[model samples]
Target: MQLTITYFALLRDQRGLDTETIDSPAATPAELYTQLAEQHSFTLPSSALKVAVNDDFAHWTTPLKDGDTIVFIPPVAGG
Candidate 1:
């Protein structure tokens, strides 16, 4: 399936890009993150992030489909 992913904060810095579209065999966000973590050497684990699908907050186990837009949001600190 084809997925569009948006990276933010630490994830974006680690990935070195804000967004990307790629073909993947992952069936869920959790799976996708694991695939990406390995491919990109992301420092944070999936347990440290929240996921969203198509702009809506989604559970990690949410079923993924072709053309889905997903974001893996990392923790943020503000002054």
Candidate 2:
């Protein structure tokens, strides 16, 4: 199945991409992230990030379906 992924902050800089379409067999957000982290060498672990599906906040274990748009939001430090 194919899904769209969006990255933010460090994730975007690390992967050198803000968005991508991926073909994956990952069943949940966590699995999908692990796959991408390995593929892209994303440094921060999922514990330091949040996941969203279809523009709403979602759990890491949220089920993924084809054409789903996923966003992995990393921490943003602000003063």
Candidate 3:
């Protein structure tokens, strides 16, 4: 299926882009992250980030479908 992925914070830096659309065989966020981590050499683990589907916070194991927009939110720190 084709999905849209958005990156933020460290993930954006690592991915070198704010968003991208790609075709993947992943069934869930967890699987997609693992695949992406390996492909992009992302250092942070899935446990260190939060995922959102279609703008709503979602589980890492949330089912994905064609054209779903996914955002992998990295940890943030500020005063």
The prediction achieving the highest lDDT against the true structure is 1
Tens digits of per-residue lDDT for model 2 on 1-79?
9999988889989989889998899999999989998998988999999899999999999889999999988986889
Model 2 residue 4 CA deviation (Å) reads 0.2
Error of 2 at 53 (Å): 0.4
Q: lDDT ranking from best to worst? A: 1, 3, 2
- Could you tell me the lDDT of residue 47 within candidate 1? 88
Q: Write one digit per residue (lDDT tens) for candidate 1, span 1-79.
A: 9999999888899899999999999999999999999999999988888999999999999999999999998876788
Candidate 1 achieves a global lDDT of: 0.94
Q: Give the alpha carbon lDDT tens digit for every residue of 1-79 in model 3.
A: 9999999888899999999999999999999999999999999988888899999999988899999999988887878
Check candidate 2 and list the clashing pairs: none
Which 10-residue window of candidate 3 scores lowest in summed lDDT? 70-79
Clashing pairs in 1: none
| Clash tally for model 2 | 0
What's the count of clashing pairs in each model shown?
0, 0, 0
lDDT, model 3, position 18: 94
